[model samples]
Target chain A: MIETEQLTRCYGSLTAVDSLTLRAEPGQVLGLLGPNGAGKSTAMRMIAGFLAPTSGTARVCGHDVRRNPVAAKKALGYLPEGAPSYGEMTVREFLSFIARVRSVGGDKGYRRFDEVISRLQLEEVLDQPIGMLSKGLRRRVGLAQAILHNPPVLMLDEPTDGLDPNQKHSVRMLIDAMARQRTILISTHLLEEVHALCNRVAIIANGRLLADATPAELERQSRYHGAVSFSAQGSGVSREMLARIPEVASVEVDPLDGRVTVFPREGKPILEEVQTLLRTQNLEVSEIQLERGRLDEVFRHITTSAHPGPAA
Target chain B: MSAVFAIVRRELLSYFVTPVAYVFMVIFLVLAGLLTFYAGDFYDRGLADLQPFFDIHPWLYLVLVPAISMPMWSEERSSGTIELLLSLPVTIAQAMIGKFVAAWLFIGFSLMLTFPIWITVNYLGDPDNGVIFAGYLGSWLMAGCFLAIGACMSAATRSQIVAFILTAAVCFLLLLAGQPQVLDFFQDALPAKMLGALAQLSITRHAAAIARGVLDLRDVTYFVASIVAWLAAGVALVDLKRTR
Candidate 1:
């Protein structure tokens, strides 16, 4: 539903977003992962038609952002960073104002307002001024306004930034439910959020797309060797002997406790051999398990290698 | 057009909901009344027309119009809500015109509240209601000129204080440019035609002519052109800043 061809934004001497080409299909939640100042917000703004890119183009629902901005913006809902709102307006008032501005008028407007209010559970504070609401509640109100028009595409920047864990879960569930029909592009620094919510993750750094794949694919790509961590009785299994075992690349032992972390090279099934060696040495094996690589490790490995870019 | 009206309605509702509109109206009414009656010495002059009342508009609007319009775009920019506004499907011109019309209407509303003064003058004597009506027209048009200036200044900065100060300073210069004291100072250095043109551009000269029950097309065009020029500048500034 959304596509960008070499989309870039430059401010004077600084290139905020550099030739980022990306696409999000219908019913897909594309998680845009990047650290601070990685052009995540700038990229989203370009797609939303708020900020024009210095070069290239961004299109939404087949409409060019710059050429047909109204049509392009009409197809997309954007929750900008910080989710700014008119503090003096009540929750209902703000949503109604946005609804009118978005041209969701007549019965559709009222229906959408009611639907979003209830969907985001903003009915309780609907009458209260938005300035008095907590940050989490205000963020939800921002979400309510963005989704009121039921646009085909949704670009949310840090949707769950300040929410508590439960609120985050509910919001995630909401986005996941909304993804059944709309194309959702979310930019967040939270790695676990991508693993939990998005099907396809795009890791960006230095204004470039470094890795774009499924969470499991990223983990697999980052693994060149596997490690097994186990605990045993403080007895005859010397660290030197464990390192000497066939297929075992290295063994790291804890000095205070009798725990050994064993790294085995690829194509090595050293678990069975290690079990046999423990049995032969008459050492009691307490526990043994394979360590699955995490997405955090993948994120760090990818972003650390990607040079830091200018602030967007 | 509907989008413009929606913004106008929202802006009007905001004014009523906040204390800004009430404070502005009360302050303007009281000041206009005091300046027109006591300060201008209306009874002592014994004029059947509203010339005394209309004469002070340029000075009144120098302060009052900015009080109402300084926050028009500055507050939006300060709160970061300009992003939300610009990102909407509305055109920048529509938004700019919408805000300008809203602030203009507000100043018009406050101007209308001076009806009691008109009633009081009519009750005391046979005042020329035609001149009074024309005077009101002139005052409203002049207020629009000041409001446009305020809108442009508001667009230039995020601080309302700065907007107000800059607008007031520019308007003060515009007002003073027509006075003999300032014109005489420039008389030796500038050509007579240039000095006359500078004074003609001042809102005071044209507004004074309109206040005298004369509906000069030249004065009407001055106010309209002033409003249009500043509003166009405002739209251009907003467009430039949006990209920034």
Candidate 2:
């Protein structure tokens, strides 16, 4: 439903968004992860038809942003980075104006407005001027405006950036609910937001895509994949014995708890063999588990350890 | 069309929601009264016409109209709502025209409020109602020209102060184009025909023609064309700044 090809945006000698190519299909939630100044907002703005790309094309549905901004913008619901809104207007007034502009009016428009207002919990402050609302409520109102028309594509930049944990959870769940119908491309620094909400994750750094894959696929690339960890109290299952087993590349034992974490050679699965040893040898284990791989590790390793990609 | 009206309604409502609209109206009415009754010598002249009333309009609008128009786009930029406005489905031209018409009708409303003055003129003497109507029309249209300049400048800057100052400076220069000094500056450098053409472009030339009850096509064309030109520039500037 959304795509960009070689989308480059440069500011003089500095390239803010460099040759970015991204896609999000219908019913897919793509989490765009990057550090600050990663050109995430810039890329989103270009795709939303708010900012022009220095080169290349950004298409919403099938309309090119630069060539057909009106149609392209009609297909998008964009929440700008700061959630900027008309401060002088009341929440109801602002949403009504958006509904009018988006042509989401009449019977169906009222229903959509009520639904978004209830979903975002903007009832008490609906009549209050938007300038007086707190930041969290303002963010929710911003979300309400974007989704009021129920567009096909939603580009949200740092959607859950400043909210408290509870507010963050509400927003996450809202995105989760909405993710099943529309294409969602959300840029966030929080990895857990991706874990909880995203079906696909794209890791970017220095305005370049480092890795784009599903969560399981990214986890499989983790170094800790297939490693087995167990806290054994008795039954004489020693770290030496685990290391002596076939495919056991290395072992680490915790001095405080006498737990052993084994790493398998050639990325082999050692959990089944270790479980067999525990059954055959009658090892009394307090905790036994296999690492599903940490996304934080993959995120950090790919973002930091890898080269910074092509120069600006 | 509904999209344009949505923007227009919102813009108009915002102007009234704050103290800005009331303050501008009070200052404008007070200044128009002061200039017409005191500076232009309305009673002293003892004429049956509204000549003095229309005489001070050019100078009054030069300062007051910019104050009304300087925030149309500058506020959008400073408040960061320009991004929101552009992200919507409306085109730049539609947005610009919507805002332009809102301010235009606002100035028209203020001009309409001066009807009591026209009535007072008629009660005091036998004033030409047709001429009075033409003067009001000319003043409103010329105010549009000034507003277009201010709106364009506002789009160029995020600071309303800068927009006001720049608009006043440009309007002052355009007003200067009517003065005899402009000819002295350009008389020797350019041919007489070119100098004459420059003088014809002066705002006071067309404005005076209309105020004198001569609604020539050229004067009407000049105001309408200049309004369109400046508004078109405003749309272009909006597109330019949105990309930045």
Interface DockQ of each model: 0.69, 0.69
Off by over 4 Å in 2: A230-245, A251-261, A272-288, A306-312
CA lDDT scores, all candidates in order: 0.85, 0.87
Model 2: per-residue lDDT, tens digit, B1-244? Answer: 8899999999888889888788878888888888899898899999878878887888888999899889989998888888899999999899988899999999999888888788899899998898889889888988999999998998889899999999999888888897888778898999999998888888977877776766788888898998899989988998886556
| TM-score, chain B, predicted structure 1 | 0.97
Per-candidate TM-score against the hidden true structure: 0.93, 0.93
Instruction: List, residue by residue over A1-312, the lDDT tens digit for candidate 1.
Output: 999999998888888889998899998999999889989998998888778788999999999998999888888888988999989888878887888788789987788788888899998999999999999999999898789889899989999998999999999999999999899999999988997789888888877888778776776654433567788876444567788887988887777786787777764767787777778887777888776556787788888964543222
lDDT tens digits by residue: candidate 1, B1-244: 7788889988888898899999999999999999988878889988767787888888888987888888888999899888788777888888888898998898899999999889888988998788789879988888899999999999999999999999999899888888888889999999999999999988767877976878788989999999999989988887777567
